[model samples]
Target: MPTQQEIELQAAAFRRLQKHLMEDRTDVQNIDMMNLAGFCRNCLSRWYAEAAAEKGIEIGKEEARELFYGMSMQEWKATYQTEATDDQQKAFKTAFKENVGQE
Candidate 1:
């Protein structure tokens, strides 16, 4: 098991990664992320929700998304999301299945 300090460090690293994705790299679309990295902002938000659940905290998906995004999902999409290309979508399906298992 990790020490308390290790847990804090991991949290700090996660926050930095969130900032990098949310603030510094707005041009990187979620679909493209899933295609290449098999994860995206949505996946991160879902993981956040799951983590809260493990702690006996009941966080709904949208609420977790809002908390992680610092805004509503609709707002984030309107502001930064782009439509995916056909090939990107195809790649995303394979990546999603491989990484996330099923739809």
Candidate 2:
């Protein structure tokens, strides 16, 4: 098991990554991220929810999403999300199956 300091360091790194994605890189679309990297903001939010569950904190999906995005999902979509290109959409199908199949 990791020491308290190690866990804190990991948590700090996660916060930095979250800020980078949610605050610094709004241009990066979730669909594109899913297509290219097999995960996205939504995935991160879900992971957050899962983590909270593990800790017996009971955070729901929307709540987790709001915490991660620093805003509602709809607001983020309105402000930053764009239409995916045909190629991106196609790639998403394969990527989704490979990365998060049937989940």
Candidate 3:
């Protein structure tokens, strides 16, 4: 097991990452993020929901998405996400396969 301080540090890092993701939607394209960073906001939301499930806390997918996106995921998609280009789509498939890890 990690030491308490290590866990806290990781938690703080996660919060910082989540905050950045929530606020900087325009600076990061979801497809490019998936391709380069190995995950996107949707993936983060899913992981959040999975973590809740592990503790018998049932967080709905929409709720999880809202937590990550700072809005309903549908709203975020309609407002910010653009159609992926062919190269982006192809890269995302490869990257997702590599990085999805479990969820």
Clashes of 1: 0
Taking the tens digit of each residue's C-alpha lDDT, what string does model 1 give over 1-101? 99999999999999999999999999999998888888999899999999999999999999999999999999999999888888988898899999889
CA-only RMSD, every prediction? 0.9, 1.2, 2.5
Candidate that beats the other on TM-score, 1 or 3, i.e. the better one: 1
User: In candidate 1, how many Å is residue 44 off?
Assistant: 0.7
After superposition, candidate 2 runs with Cα above 4 Å error: none
Report the Cα lDDT for candidate 2: 0.91
Give the better candidate number (2 or 3) by TM-score: 2
- TM values, all candidates: 0.94, 0.92, 0.80
* Top-down lDDT ranking: 1, 2, 3
Q: Give the TM-score of candidate 1.
A: 0.94
Q: Which candidate is the best by TM-score?
A: 1
Which runs of model 3 end up more than 4 angstroms from their true locations? 3-5, 101-103
Q: Give a tens-digit lDDT track for model 3, residues 1-103.
A: 9999999999899998888877754668888988988888889899999999999999998999988778887888888778889999989888888988633
Local accuracy of candidate 2 as per-residue lDDT tens digits, 10-37: 9999999999998898898898899878
Task: Give me the displacement of residue 85 in model 3, in angstroms.
Answer: 0.7
Q: How accurate is candidate 3 locally (lDDT)?
A: 0.85
